[model samples]
Target: MRKNYLLGMALMASLSFYSCDKEVIYVQDGNGVESVADGAQIITLQVENGGDGLATRAGRPLYSAEAKQTIENVKLWICDNTGKVVYVKEISNWNTDGSTVYTTGGHGRQTTIELKDMDKLAAGSYKVYAVGYSNSSDYVLTDVTNVAEDGNFSENMVLSLSNTVGEEIFAGQMEFTVETGKGFKKPIVLNRQVAGAFAYVKDIPFMEGAKYLKLVASAQNQSLVLGNFNSVDLAGNGSGNDANVKYVVNGENGKSGSETYEISSIDLNEWFTAIKDENGDNLIDAGDNWKNPYSSEGHPTFQKGSAFGGEFVIPFAHVDGKQTLTLQLTNAGGNVLRSWKVNLRSSDEQLDQTITCWNSVSTDWSTEVTDESANIYSLVRNHLYGIGTRMNDDPGEGTDPEPNPSDPDDQPESLNNKQELVLKVNDNWEVIHGMELD
Candidate 1:
């Protein structure tokens, strides 16, 4: 039951007409998709997810078990030379989806889906787009038009992860020609599209009186679009941290002057896959766990010591830019003692919202910067930067916990004090060891 699908095109995954409920469509010459050619070109496709999701080292070719499994659907597409999507299919539930057994690349016993429609297409240039994800309702494909028509790739394929938690998304694309018997042979390699983070604090002399310490990370922008610019926009729909944040303290008789105020910070627990712990997981005890580069994948497995540290995964962010995770020392009365902003940024590029970066040491936090690859100072996708810092130095400035992007009193600076941001990066579930503040 096939027909010419030359109708209006929308790039949404949940389009009623093009639902991802294991639907398949192809292009044919006649008005109606009836009698097909004798031998339609069918291409065998398999996927390979290199070394567990994240790496402890740069470009470390380690695969991840999270990527190995949890692939609920492989939404694959074939676009014409001009970016007009012609063929579409959702390969899922491989057990009965007419897929053959595939055990070569990543996890054993996957599937080898036979792709059609290439031969039906006239010989010319074409591209293959594939996105593998765990959930069907977590992503949105928007801000793209005309390309879905007969236009060029003038716009972006906005894969909005703004509202999504740390959901692991893998994408692969390739260009090829529809000529003779030749077809793509190499396995499509899917790479991680998010980053990982965690914090730890130790030896905070006043924490003995403050009782407990916690880490709060705030991102100025939520990665709205994906492209060369890595497009982003202000978080409005529930915000990057949502309108209401967790662990909030409305400055009631607050000891720390600035600490007693409305705080709008990204809830690490809500946005990230796993919030280190309800309080914090002491990362100092992370002996063997610290050894693994992609340890962020095993959130629950991390053993907590006496320090306030734990790990979670986040979207690809410019940590050195508008995103930062700060350490806060609070007394039992929910009063702030001293705060230190993980100085990763070189400038004051913050979100449009009213967020402060808190007071850092007299000397701002600076890192050995370079390209995104070597700059463990920034938060990039498919990479991990383990933050092993010791907050044993004197508390820098004001105690207001709510970070203001426009605040000039206590601004962002280079890494000062003995606070060395232990950002050791690697590749999937890329591991960024927790930090420790004394």
Candidate 2:
């Protein structure tokens, strides 16, 4: 009788649905509820009749089944213990067999969702909710489960150096080693994304002597490592190296030193140009001072008694632009070797100057300068005069040649017109045998 009544009602509704444009109303408790308008219908969702429940693991697949009736759009979401939605998926079509599987008409289908990287998901309980909506109504269903038994472990570690700029030391190649406890497996090297973050898959086997491991981080083309973790001794022994290994932090121990220099009154621009040696050849080349007209056979040679000294020329064009200039030096290991700051003062008149060092051979290792006026600078090594320059002169426009008592090729003492600035170690201005510029 119930079947007959349902069949009779379906027949009456189908017939009364008459005009294709006429809406089909649903009456509840004899109160006629407005029928859903054309293109309007409620969507409902629930676990599929024969579908399996949701299952997940750390490294396992995420599985879930859902049923949707022509109600509306269907969406599924997975949320963490904190109620934060971690995953969302949309279902567009849900159809099977000839008969509509969904309780609502026009909707029919069952679907299984898949998820990965479950191990990255935090260990805790989570919830999955399915929402269905159509023009007329909506439906929601939810399920909750514990994720602790997902069998995936977290393997993350943070690495840092006492020095803030340590990671930037070796042209960006920082190497480090890992140690796992005995019986623990070595973790899989995943990725090093941040300055101090490294991710690994827990997997390496930990041997007895693996209590501590040493790793050397080095830069390419460099002979020495930028940094090393030598005292990272593990406290426990384990079968597989877990990502949660504790590190025995220690103080940073490495090579350190410094360099210093003194500067006389000079134009800020000229002072900076004097030190700009971009090629790092240890000599001031033609390009060093764009306005200076001079060329050398090659990079300047710096050593005791070498004609090509390390003294550099100051261009007259740059003066009174700024005040103080400082140069910073770093060793191959990125350690601050030294920094020199020079105070610049306005000169009464453009004066010729000379800077001298007492010891010649030891200058290269100890003497280096940078132009704080500009970031222009260079390193002088093993040469008596690392840089030097003379006023640009026409090939043959100078006065009468010098009548030297010995060599005619040499200009006369009075007519020796070459105006050159010479930088020497421990030499005084009076001992300077160069011509005076007007």
Candidate 3:
């Protein structure tokens, strides 16, 4: 037996800036008007995958793999012709798994949903909408019932870094006119609301016996704020000094040997200047680019506003072009072992390059033939400040200056200083010879 449930209460909800499709199809009666003898209507609420809702084939799934999830419930809304929400419904009960909920019969086996007390709906043009989600608690609810202005809806659907479930949100809307007697079968095609980027380490030989590697987003926080459906507006008041707000790759347990980390929400600013004026001189110099450990014998957190922190930085948000991500290899004792501060972007590029500085097959950094003409190691050594060595044409080449020249031995320059690392490459570039830090 089919049960008929009704929530006769009127729904007063807030409006959002998101728009819906304007075209509507009405199945007319002999009188050319829709008529529902019992003042009830049935609609097919389609549950499909949610990325860029493109079906590769005619009957393929709707969402892309990166944004696909099992949708558990849907929040439906009916708005008046004036763009005012008139009714709302929350539907959760369904028959099959979300992946198989949509079938070929045009009617869902056990997924039928109803809009009750249709007769109470005033005669006017209207639009119907549905939004589906898996985890309800992950999102901040927006009570838009009282706001009178247009739909600049609050960040009601923002997904945080902790929200492993609500990462995929889907919604669909259609416009239709409501008359005294009619409803027809309608389908809602849900679209996904997020974008993603990924990172990984390459050439393990240089990083042997290493147990930790972290990728830190200079200004981004652990939580990602989805301001717009497909856009991420990084949180925090641009106060990049907040330690807890900055997002760092927290690998499972402690370290991940070359595992890829997904960074979904990030804001890239070309002119981002960190407060590196260590001398209070109000100007940036090599002295300020040093990565400072939180405390003695502690791991270094890339300095708050330094230029580059030895981690791969991909400006996915920047339109100019893709930038290269640099890599640093360190020892178990927190000493800089090797720095491959080169233009290696993708893993394929890193693996295919002819440079023989560090390789996996050798399993030993020393075995790498630095004498190879194309070897990056030789190029790095060419810049070292030997007693009578001629400075390479590269003016950027030289010996690393002491980070704190006063206590040069105890506070040696960190590898985060590109110029210093290059100048002292022979010492800092190899674990067998580099000056180990305290």
Candidate 4:
């Protein structure tokens, strides 16, 4: 009896050890094994506006509409063709309001999970699942899609002006139209690039609370074409040098149009000269001398401010049901000088908005306004700069120049040197606006 009791205690100890060493697995089936295949590939998932799907057949990329809540904490994962887990990653949040929830990801809300190194992916159909957690909760929200061909289908387009740089200086205006085979929805005009591509959809006119339409971009006379798969930049070199170039529109449907214009470079030398002659003095001695106020970086200039203003016309074809249009600006340098955006609605109503960089440190850096036009709403922001009358006197007659008041405790007042103009268009085009420095 003593031997039997000792044996039973040994057996219990062994069972306890075994339980501690066992791995915990969560399985869809009531099996103890984790049923994940090795070397599986998972693709990125996309989120669409209005809870729509972003399949290519749907004609529009998936997107999340502008909402009051912020999206945050986007996590992505992948699986192989053989139903095995392969890879996982977390995405950085890109919203402005600091919300950690993610409304959309993976190819502008179309593909949720993008399979990495797809070239290495074996030729087979695979399934991808995406789980998104909102900023409000940790519950994993799931979205899934199928991956077939190892290539991308969507195309990207960009537009910009060479002469429009520095503070809000007027360049030109353009009108764009897009048509696709699939039905499109919930157009967005983005100021920044999406997924490594620039978008020109800003400060235009469109309908309010509409989901199916998006605007890519608008510029003086240039547009960019993008690759059908990756957002590779395409040249719109129509017929001219950099000083005066034209834009040519080409797409899968063979649509074509043109915009004519000239390029501009900034003339910093002229501005420096004007600043030195503030007191009507021609020399830069003593009181007239100022610190190096010129930029070593290149400035933006225009084609002699021609009296013959030009217009841009862009056309689209390949009408199926609905299509998404995108525009972008590339290789932008220096401070943005000025911009304008206008949108024309189907009801012949227009909406417009403009932004002018303000010189306030405490106040908002920009101002905005809205206006309406006939079938063409307009948004304009014209920024200007001027020298102030406050003068500075050199303390040593011809030595170190000091503030006119010469009080070491006094602070120099702020001044506006240059102006910039920017325009943006929301998905809703009902509001027209503009802004300027007072």
Winner by lDDT: 1
**Tens-digit lDDT track for model 1 on 136-244?**
4344544321224343443224454433234444444555566554433322333444443434322223223444345455442233232221111111111112222
1-438: candidate 3 lDDT, tens digit per residue: 001111100000000000010001111121223334454565544442211111111111111011123445556566676666666656563224421332232112224455565424655776655555454434433432232333433322323333321133344455555556654543343333222111111112213344333222112222222221211111111111222111111111112244323222111111122323345443332333433222232322122232211211111111112211123343445454444322211221112323222222332222222121111212111011110011111111122221222321122133332321111111100101111111
Please give the distance, in angstroms, between residue 262's alpha carbon in candidate 3 and its true position after superposition. Answer: 7.3
Candidate 3 residue-wise lDDT at 229: 20
Residue 257 alpha-carbon offset, candidate 4, angstroms? 14
Candidates in order, TM-scores: namely: 0.48, 0.16, 0.37, 0.19
Q: Taking the tens digit of each residue's C-alpha lDDT, what string does model 4 give over 82-116? A: 54544444433523321222222101222222233
Q: Which ten residues in a row have the lowest lDDT in candidate 3?
A: 9-18
Whole-model Cα lDDT of every candidate shown, in order: 0.31, 0.18, 0.26, 0.19
- Please report, as a residue range, the 10-residue window in candidate 2 with the lowest summed lDDT: 1-10
Model 2 bad stretches (over 4 Å): 1-68, 95-108, 118-120, 135-438
lDDT of 1 at 194: 45
The TM-score, computed over Cα atoms with residue i paired to residue i, of candidate 2 is 0.16
Instruction: For candidate 1, give the lDDT of residue 408.
Output: 30
Q: Candidate 3 lDDT (Cα, whole model)?
A: 0.26
Better of 1 and 4 by TM-score: 1
TM-score of 1: 0.48
By TM-score, the better pick of 2 and 4 is: 4
Candidate 1: stretches off by over 4 Å: 1-69, 93-110, 116-120, 136-138, 141-155, 161-165, 200-213, 228-299, 304-324, 331-335, 338-376, 388-418, 429-438
Distance (Å) between predicted and true CA of 378, model 2?
Answer: 90
